[model samples]
Target: MRNILVVNGSVSGDASVSRALVEVAVQRLLGINPDASVTHRDLSHGAVPHLTPATVAGVRAVANTDHELSTQALSDELIAELQAADVVVIGAPMHNFSIPSSLRAWFDHVLRRRVTFSYSEAGPKGLLTSKRRHMRSFDPPW
Candidate 1:
């Protein structure tokens, strides 16, 4: 892959096992493709905000107010990031049997209805077809 997007969703910071796994995976990928460029998104520090009415409106492309418009722009930016990536690596540790809130919020921002996916007569089809996704979920005993 030419462009790799790495997402860290661990709240435990440097102590996260999932993050370590992602690091190893990234290093292996880099060994395979020495010329590939990597981008990182750390979700532990609130880089992506929780879903709100304004953000929802933005994702739906019906933004009106200034807050909604701004959120829409942010969503567009995230979508562009996803679109530009050749491979996506996600480090997500299982918390309460689900993903972290920040990662969920990241999904809320990028997963647009007509933009990223669409419903067809058969089933839902993702618009991003060629990108590869690698995810590591380390479920530690809590």
Candidate 2:
């Protein structure tokens, strides 16, 4: 069975257009693959903590170190979820021409060094090759 991860970044929750788009996408995906499993991470409802100096330090720290932080736990969970997914769908609303803070925070946790990507002498390269679809919502008259 394929694993599909859906991330909702809209502050308007269920009423947001981004979420509606995600729903449609999910329906289409399930229609294609009946055995696919869907998992959701509602960023607005469960806001990801903003990265701090301590969080960065925790990320760089050695595993099983004396200094254990909550950030490490959170990052581990987020990264694991991303790594396990065969497909990812992100629903983000554009605010001031940028992504929502919650969505950005979610990225921060999942986009870990040596986890989601790695740097070589050439350049930074992504480790994740999972199919990703980004759905953006805008103020609309359409």
Candidate 3:
């Protein structure tokens, strides 16, 4: 892939095994494609805010207030990043059998209705036609 997006969702930061795994995967990918570029999004540092009514309004393109407008801008930016990337690597350490809240928040921001997907007569249709590779590091809680 020419453009790679590495999203780290582990709150454990440097101590996260999932993050380490992602690093290895990224390095391997880079080794194969020496000219490829990589962009990182660390969600543990409050980079992605949890969804609120304002954020919902923004993602829906009904933003009116300043807060909603700002949230919408963020959502747009995140979606743009996703659209530009050819590969997406996600580090997700199991948090009570689910992904971290920050990662969930990121999903909430990027998975915009009619932007990433749409309803069809048969079923849901995906609008992002570009081929994407997703590598997620899932650590099960024992």
Q: How well does each candidate superpose onto the true structure, as a TM-score?
A: 0.90, 0.83, 0.89
lDDT of 1 by residue, 41-120 (tens): 88998978987765679877789988888888988988988999998888878988999888999998889988899999
Output the better candidate (2/3) by lDDT: 3
The numbered model that scores best in lDDT is 1
Residue lDDT tens for model 2, 1-142? 3998999889895579888888877777788898999999999866587776556655543435333366777778888888899878888789889998889889877877787888999999899876554454434433
Instruction: Indicate the worst ten consecutive residues by lDDT in candidate 1.
Output: 133-142
RMSD of each: 3.3, 3.6, 3.3
Q: Considering summed lDDT, which 10 consecutive residues are worst modelled in model 3?
A: 133-142
| TM-score of candidate 3 relative to the true fold | 0.89
Clashing pairs in 1: none
Which regions of candidate 1 are displaced past 4 Å?
133-142
lDDT ranking of the models: 1, 3, 2
